[model samples]
Target: MPTSVKIFDTTLRDGTQGEGISLSVEDKIKIARKLDELGVHYIEGGWPGSNSKDIEFFERTRTMTFKNAKITAFGSTRRKDSKACDDINLNRLVDSGVQVATIFGKSWDFHVTTAIQTTLEENLNMIYDSVQFLKSKGLEVIYDAEHFFDGYKNNAEYALQTISKAQDAGADWIVLCDTNGGSLPGEIAQIVGAVKAHVSTPVGIHAHNDCELAVANSLAAVQAGAGQVQGTINGYGERCGNANLSSVIPNLQLKLGYSVLSDEQLKSLTSVSRYISEIANMHMPINQPFVGNAAFAHKGGIHVSAILKDASTYEHIKPELVGNKQRVLVSELAGQSNVLVKAQELNLDFDRDPQKSKEIIEKIKEMEHQGYQFEGADATLELILREAFEGLEEIFTLESFKMLVEKTANHAVVSEAIVKVKVHGETIYTAAEGNGPVNALDNALRKALIQYYPDIKNIHLSDYKVRVLDEKDATAGKVRVLMETTDFSSTWNTLGVSSNIIEASWYALVDSLRYALLGRTRIEREDKDQLEQLGVVNH
Candidate 1:
């Protein structure tokens, strides 16, 4: 039988410490529920006493039930020379009323001396007292010895003593933490091996990604007999980041055959990763391992040709296993097979026509020459296909648009824009003022279109990004704008490119709204198809 490895996820705690990641109480609860569903052995929520939001999380989460996961409350150990039971902060950890307690203690001499202003001996006493006290209260104690790797490197005896003290105090799991995130894989393995030999309790490892070696170090520790892997989902943390359990969990189970998540839970990995990213309002990293946009995305004729023959030639694991599907990107470098796969993915019935495939491939190549990158603009490509197959209904058209901006004496740059659009055999004109020319133009167009399509009231631009096509300075310089919008149901992103900023912005903005409505239309169409199949459409 393979060893059973416990996966401890800290996305709600450590991951929230990542730059620009601040979750509300509601956000934390949602993420915690997802993590529980993901089959993580332990969910390390934030320090409850430190913030009201976290306090609310514990208060609310305690009432819920998790069939497989335990909610662990995280905090630092007792203060120096303070009895754990007497320490107010430690009492707060107990009062949080969780089944598990994960407390961090000083392990490195430098942190003990400088950060905590305590002596080395006092730090050991703090670890011992905290774990013993928690155990006395019948809580499962997980002692995370902060900076353990560096502490072991500098003062081996001191680090070993800290681990020993936690074990002696009846800690259920003695977790070695690389708080500084500077240790290499070899050192991690060696220190973890030494710690395992020195202690009888289950040993665990927590690593950060300062040197971009958190994942490697975590695997090394597991090989060295550590039973638990501590990391945040998506590798989110302060400074660089912590180990990513998304990669760690799958690698451990698939490569080493160490049991972590169940096969069913593992299949939800991609959805879980994206769900958290969406709630946190962060763009998911396109190259994130196992479950990213580019994880299974293939391009280039040679690679696509081989992938078509057998995915295992380039893929390490089946894409479906991680809740992700293989994607064939259409670019200038792509071949006929790439387009065919893409068309298939879109469920377009091209009838396996070689001539039609060649034509689409040529059209993509021509679009690429015009600074229209299809890889980043799949919605646009879908629109192009819809127009080609079913034809498009142009209910509205932009006749002309212009803007003027000037600096006033008391005010900053003043801007006004006028838009003339023809809709439903009528020409409507609108003028709007804004902080900038782009804003003015957007407001004017949106104001005019709301009357024609009342659903446009649900449409609002959520995000906008502009990128320069080339570094050259001249009339040849082209710009691309990506726009994201949300309707009542879902969000969609589209892109446009032009030498004129207004033109590019308008193209992206118009498509963004249309894409949202189009998605709803498709969902309705699918529902109708199901109804027809069941003979319920007439009803």
Candidate 2:
């Protein structure tokens, strides 16, 4: 029988600590419920008394039941010289009605002497009394020895003594934290092994990603006998970040045979990861482990061919295991199998046209050489592939456009934009005013396009970003514009770059609209085909 590991997720707590990630009470509750459904062993809600949102979460979460997971309230230990029962923070934790309590105490001498302005012994007392107090109140207490790894390296004996204090005081679990995230995997395993031998309580590991080794260190600690792993869902935390439970859970259970979530539900990992990213309004890390966009994507010809024959040749785990679909990308370096797989994904039926496939792939690679990364934006890439094979309609074209900006008497900037377009021998000229020149131009373009494509009304610009390619001289650098757009159902991103900001924006705007229209068309066709197959429609 495989040993079971507890997956303690702290996304709502630690993830929100990420700068600019301030989730409301409703958001936290929503995420907590989803995590419980996903079978996390524990969900670390935020410190109730520290913030209003967290306080609201505690109050609201009391009424909800997480079927599989224990809801944990996270906070620091009671202040030095304060009785645990009387400490307002401790009372808040109890009143919160959380079944579990995680209290952090300074383990590093530097933090004790400098940050907290307290003696090392007083910190130990704080950790011990807090754990004992919470445990006595019938809550499972987890002692977080903040900066434990660094403290252990600095003063090995003191760090051990602090953990011993928590264990002796009734902490159910002792979490060793790499707060600075500077420890390597080998060092982590060795230290965790040592800590396990010394501490009586079950050891858990909490790591940060400063060195980009939080996940690796957490796993190493588990291999070294830690039964619990604490992390954020998408590795969200302050500074570099905490360990990513999404990666940790899969690696521990699938790669190491330690039971975490249900084996069947492991396939939902990708969708879950993307869902959290969407909720947080953060860009999903394409290269994230196990469930990332590129986790199972094949690009090179040799790799694609081998993957088609035997996936295990290069892949460590099956793509479907993490709910991630395998992507055989078509580029100049792609083989026949790459083209076939790409075509199949797009529902394009082809009968072994190696020459045609090669030509299309070569064209894609040539375009990619001109600063287009199709793999990064699959929707745009899919459009390009379809256009190469089926030829896209021009429908409408940009003829000439001019924008004028004027500062009003009230110092508010007014933008006026005019556009002229010829659509199938019909000339349409439109003028619009907007808050800014870009908005004006955007309005003008939309005004012109909606005449033929009324569905364009459903398209909305979600986000726009501009980056300078070269910063050697601020005045002379190429600029890149990235635009994110949403239609009825899905979202897509497009990129364009030029020396001129307007030109770059225009390219990205047009491509973003094209991607949306193309996706809508594909979805409609797919629905029609499904209806036909179900005998609801006939050709």
Candidate 3:
């Protein structure tokens, strides 16, 4: 069996320290459950005594059962003059009802002398008393030597003494923290190796990313006999953020041969990263390592050609292994292989018709030169390809549309739109009012087609983004509209470009509806085919 390195996720406690990150109690619980599902060994819940929301989180999560991760409450050691048993922070950790307690104390002499204004001996006493008190309470104690790296560099003997005190007090794990996040990977390895030699207790590492070396330093610590790794999902934390567990886990499991999470649990890494980002209402970094959107995306002609032959030619690892897929992005740099790969991914048959593939490649290059980006709008690209090769017919034809906006003297504005559509050669006209012209237009168009295709009601636009093609041209510049729609089954993006923003938005909206209707039609046809196969119906 391979060595198992424990994964300690501090997203709830340390991650919220990042700017603009505020997690409600409910959000904390949701994230805890998700982290549990992702197979983290330990989850550091926030300081119970620091705030009411964190207190509430501990209270609510007391009843919630986690499968693999043990909930750990985080806090500092006993205060300057307080005994461990009488410390309010230590009492809150006990009341939090977590099985593990992780407490930090000043390891650096500078912090002990200046920040805490306490004697070096008293800080050592604090570490010993706190860990022993927690251990006496039937709670596992993990002592965090705050600023351990900086402290070790300044006074190695005193820094080693702090960890030694915790180890003597029966600390289960003594974690060396690069709290300042200034140490490089080589320095981390040397310090961790020295600590391993000095302390008998199991060692762990907590790294920050001020130098973009958090992940590197973490892996280095592991190589130097640190049994536990502490980080956050997506590297969320204060300053530059902590080491990203999404990157660390894979590096340990796949690259270093250390088992952190099971292969099956590791597959959820990308989804878990995205889920946290969604809950935080933050944009997922498309270029983040391992779990990012562009992790396995190929665009260059030579790269795409080689990747199509064998994915490993350009990719470091199979994307599906990390819950991601290889994306052959269509752009001006795309070649015939890029078109073929993208077409195949969309379930379009272009293998037998090489001419159609060339046409798509040419068309994409031309559109890209005209400032029409298709990389982010796969649904639009699929529609164009289907129309060219599969002979996809228009589900509905737009006859005409008119939008009206009226503002009265009282300052109340009313927006209404009327849409005319031809479905199966029958003309339908519908009008609707909304808070804005775009909403009104969307309502009117959907109302016109609802009777003919009731499934259109299930499809609703989730996101709409508009960008100016050329800012120098100002009002004369063309606008690109991207619409993301979902029908409970899947989400897809459609795009349109025009000088008029309304026209561009209308075009994207229409394509979104048509794409959804096309999916419904295909499913219905498949259902009919299955029935015919069972001899229940005849064509």
**RMSDs, each prediction?**
3.1, 3.6, 1.8
Candidate 1 wrong stretches, greater than 4 Å: 113-119, 351-353, 404-407, 411-417, 424-436, 439-453, 474-476, 513-539
Best-fitting candidate, scored by lDDT:
3
- Per-candidate clash tally: 0, 0, 0
lDDT of 1 at 45: 85
Q: Provide TM-scores for the models.
A: 0.90, 0.87, 0.96
TM-score between model 1 and native: 0.90
lDDT of each: 0.86, 0.84, 0.91
Best-to-worst lDDT order: 3, 1, 2
Candidate 2 error regions (>4 Å): 106-124, 154-157, 330-337, 349-355, 397-400, 405-413, 422-425, 436-438, 465-481, 495-504, 518-539
Q: By descending TM-score, how would the candidates be arranged?
A: 3, 1, 2
Return whichever of 1 and 3 wins on TM-score. 3
lDDT measured at residue 251 in model 3 versus the true structure, 0 to 100: 92
Candidate 2 lDDT tens digits, 296-350: 8889989988987899988988889888877776666776777777888877765
Clashing pairs in 3: none
